[model samples]
Target: MLEIVPIRSDSRARARVKVRPPAFLGEPEPDTSVGQEISKAGVGIILCAGALIGLGGFLFFIGGLLTSGGITGFVKGWLTAFTGI
Candidate 1:
């Protein structure tokens, strides 16, 4: 013979908060050097990219200045090219 147990219905909802991992989950290994190396590499990559972008922008500006002269030259060139005068 089997007996059935009845659960009581509480008016309030239970608080569901996950404070800790289940016992079966393995603990992570602590390696400070790995995180530090990753951060250093990330910073290096960011700095290199920023430098490249700045260099490219400088080259573009110089090229634009050489191509026409400056704002006035660019406008004159544009007017001459379109108006043929």
Candidate 2:
């Protein structure tokens, strides 16, 4: 197989190396509008998960109030208000 090597101006065995500029000479470009959309979606997911967790906790609390021994009038009232039972 033929090997590709850099051409040298000198007749010497050493090869001349060409200098190149830095790969990144300046600051990177800013993110586009898609980045904003991703940010909004992330926030939306967090909010949705939080709301679901809060609702689940509320339901669990209500269940506890209804199921615990010696149910009080206040607990019954709350259960009736929430479940219409």
Candidate 3:
């Protein structure tokens, strides 16, 4: 015959409150996790950098084409890209 022992209810809840791995389940509703916060910040930085680089490149290309030959240069560049010639 085996005897079963039950843990104290309050103690069990307290144990769950302690910070540990598998953050999705153990953390409280309002608490922020260190690892998760860093990951979110890193993603935000990468997205912002990509957006800035893409916009900057587009503006530089347009500026160069306009200064070189105005609207005619822009049209020429587009046609060359489309026709691969």
Candidate 4:
């Protein structure tokens, strides 16, 4: 024969509240290094340069001011021919 131990009802009252330490309490603040900032600026500059080049090309072709070397050039030629200007 096995005897089962009974849990006391007062045991629930003894439960303690646990306080968790802040997650970032001991961590260093995020630092954006000079190299990272320079790289980000370089990317932005490259993108802006590409956009400027594309815009210049579009303006030139749209006004029939210059010719290109690809599909855009062919389309511009066709448009100019059809529009007669």
Question: Of the candidates shown, which would achieve the greatest lDDT relative to the real structure?
Answer: 3
Pairs clashing within candidate 3? none
Runs in model 4 deviating more than 4 A are: 1-29, 65-85
Residue pairs with backbone overlap in model 2: none
lDDT of 1 by residue, 1-85 (tens): 9999787686677798966644443333343467776787899999999999999999987787689979788778778989999
Query: Residue 40 of model 2: what lDDT?
Result: 74
Better structure of 1 and 4 per TM-score: 1
Better of 2 and 4 by TM-score: 2
lDDT head-to-head 1 vs 2, winner: 1
lDDT of 4 by residue, 3-57 (tens): 9999987775556898755558534335647787678789999999999999999
Instruction: Evaluate model 4: give its TM-score.
Output: 0.41
**Alpha-carbon error at 58 in model 1, in Å?**
0.3
What is the per-residue lDDT of model 3 for residues 17-59, given as tens digits with 9 covering 90 to 100? 6665553764445566788878988999999999999999999
Worst 10 residues of 3 by lDDT: 12-21
What are the lDDT figures for the candidates, one per model? 0.78, 0.75, 0.80, 0.76
- What's the TM-score of each model vs. the native? 0.46, 0.44, 0.47, 0.41
**Candidate 1: segments with Cα more than 4 A from true spot:** 1-32, 74-85
Q: 46, model 2: CA deviation in Å?
A: 0.6
**CA-RMSD of model 3:** 9.7
The reply for model 2, stretches above 4 Å from the true place, is 1-32, 69-85
